[model samples]
Target: MGQANNKTVLLPLAFALGLAGLAFLPAVHGNPKTFAAFLGVSAALSAWDALLFVSTRRGGRTLSVDVALKKQHYLQACVQGSLMAYWGYYWPPVYAFAPFILAQLVFAYAFDMLLVWSRRDVYTLGFAPFPVVVSINLFLWFKPDWFYLQFLIVALGLAAKELIRWNRDGRRTHIFNPSSFPLAVVSVFLLAAGKSDITWGQSIATTQFYPPNMYLVLFLLGMPGQFLFGVTTMTMSAVVSTYVFGRLYFAATGIYFFYDSYIPISVFLGMHLLFNDPATSPRTELGRIIYGSLYGLSAVWLYQLLGSAGMPTFYDKLLQVPLLNLSAKWIDRVAGQWFTLGRSLTARQRNLAYMSIWAVIFAGMSATQGVGDSHPGQWLPFWRQACEDGRAYACPYLADLETSFCDRGSGWACNEAGLLHIALSRSGEDLRRADPAGAAVPLRRGCELGFATACQNLNTLTSGTGSFARAQPTIEDLPIILRGSKGEIRERDPSALYALACHEGWPDTCGRSPLTANSLP
Candidate 1:
């Protein structure tokens, strides 16, 4: 009866395994379309497994171990690891996936071995592995080569586990166990070697064995070396800092949230530094400044919240009154309104009165400040008037002209107008028919105002050269233009294609050949 039941369970298990094998097809290079077909097959297999599981439960029969193990959830993880390996082998040109496979394996082995040794039942292990595996997978996805070192580190971790198990009686046999220390040392060496190999290997070969000159160069050029160094340094610092900070916070405020907040803040800062692509556009300089200011303010606020405060003077409290009182009032009012109204606006009349007062105050301020006169070529007003006068086509005409509004005070308008002129020039239209050399002025102004695309465009017309002939594009600048072009083209922007084509030689530019071909019109 047990054997017969096992065979019945094997049906779903077999189906899930087959689906997993099929799913590998999409991950293969030059066969991404096969992935869709495999996805459908996987979905079907998942449904079959679900039905089997439900039927078994309803009939008061537990799924056999083999059957339960063959579920799509487990199969999916195995397939995902295999997919990473396939990508590591085939798509090495785009990204390295080897570390991902390694990381997944390490996580699985660690969780399984740990749980099993603890004598925890299989079901008792629950879905904890899922989130742990997923988080590690995402970390690998972001930094795949990080996995190579992690594999070696896992051995040290395993040793640590054994040592902890042996010492569980709270008695130390020796300060340094001979068996433990060597394994730890070897693990550290392997981890370091793996990191160095990733970062400096390619660059050394390219530059002919010269060590990186600048600290930043290691990170920008050396992927593995920089990654390993950064990971080790940050991890060590974070562990030590957390311990110290925790002790201090506990002693002072008895708060643990401050420690919890540390990781999030550190991660945020790291991401901003690592991932926030710096803008090449001149207009973006203003944005960068604003972002910097906001970041500074946030840092101050976070410190104020987390740091021990010296008692404030009476004057200090007076200065803080506006921010504190306004925040308290806003919070109270919002909570009251939300609870009282549920969905409907119970205080509609009061709300309208408050809104009208704010609107009148804004209007009075704008009129007193003479802001309207400062914006003479108001595109919205012109469009609205033209539409009221039954000119349905005027909007498109203005868009074509790239003259949505006239505001000499507005840098954005000048930049857009410049782009419009450049597009007209590209379309083989003679701007000389209307403004002669005046067309170049907007293009030049736009470039000076920090519009990088405009700068490249104006360089083509005025400098009698393209961006390629000027100098090698910076690493930061290339990705910005490429990514922007990608987004713009995806949104059906015709002009972005030309920008993309011009940056074809950029190292990070993906699908450049197709873009270059498409841009030739």
Candidate 2:
């Protein structure tokens, strides 16, 4: 009995782990060395889980399919999210955040154990680890830097499962996809706060990382699971709609809706893995199509609207999924009513339905007022703070905004700007291509400031011998306009404009002059 139950959880987990490894392989440049920690941690956790399951089986325990499924999802979320954290950004802080991650998992496991213990026969976490894992993974993928926020999101998502339900005709159901709802809610909140970091896991998009072989490998691996979940239709529909609608929007407004290509690997993963959750999406064929179409449309619409409204694009799909998720009950009801016994919409009715959805999208997008960002004033303070704090991520955005000042003789500023570009050039084809010469402008300025390291780095970049960090900036890190140069260099700082590129902490600059350090810091 235990062996049977163990297969239930073990098979899916192994499959997911394999797929995740393949998917991240391209991004890691076929270098298994970088995945050392990721593999170690994942193996340890998975082994422990297997042992626990096997022990319970030895004690005459039998696992239900529901429990097995939950365990699979939970395992996937924890394992995949951790891998993404390590390989995605290769962010060192993941080690520091270990305690929090463990705490979150412990709490989730304890919560389920308590529920089962209290009501042995009646209580079962049917979706056991799915909701919890998804929430953790999403946070790890997007905002792992903000550990408190991750904990908050996990708590809120779990809490909502119990607290927020609609009771109708004595049949109660939660109105939101547990994992997606809190993400959507908090994403909006963070967007408003200028802290949302939605990049859609481009860190593992095989194509983006320069090697395409593993891309095919990952697609093939994930296809079986996607089909098994009956999500291929939804995933395909969302991808197609995103492309077509995105192109339409770009043509109409001269704005590139999605920075990456329409069908990047990340989109594939998200459409199948995140948005098309079997529990939240409609199960019916036609209903799934509508659900996916709505997702694509909502994603595109929100991308444009929120971007113009001064929020990040990270929340576009997050917001869209939950809103559509909330309508799952109604979608099923309508699908049932419409698809019953030889009932099919006529061509005209079908067109009308599509038109109505489009109309809503257009109206909603048009009606969204600008949030008083005529001068890009909203991000100015944020960028300035980030720059002052030596926040590396703020470098690219501020570099663009401060270019004119740099050109007009802010030597230190120009050097700093160059460093930002170098930082950004660490990842993404578009960004990498933008600085083919590799941060020559700012680095030269720093060199001119007598900063020896700046000279060395500038030499390294110019000679094309410099290497990038294991975790570097992606498309999300670039400012919208600076994504591609589109062939324009507005600034060539003249020698007349020279300032010391020195701050207290930059020891190389300190040797240049005490005044330089004082001035910049």
lDDT of each: 0.33, 0.49
lDDT accuracy of residue 199 in candidate 2: 30
Give the range where candidate 1 is weakest over 10 consecutive residues by summed lDDT. 312-321
Candidate 1: regions farther than 4 A off: 1-111, 118-123, 141-266, 269-521
Cα lDDT over the full model 1: 0.33
Model 1 compared with the native: what TM-score? 0.24
Per-residue lDDT of candidate 1, residues 223-267 (tens digit): 231132222222222223433454455355433222222222222
Candidate maximizing TM-score: 2
Kindly give the stretch of ten consecutive residues in candidate 2 with the minimal lDDT sum. Answer: 369-378
lDDT of 2 by residue, 37-91 (tens): 3344345435654664566567655444333445446544644554445333433
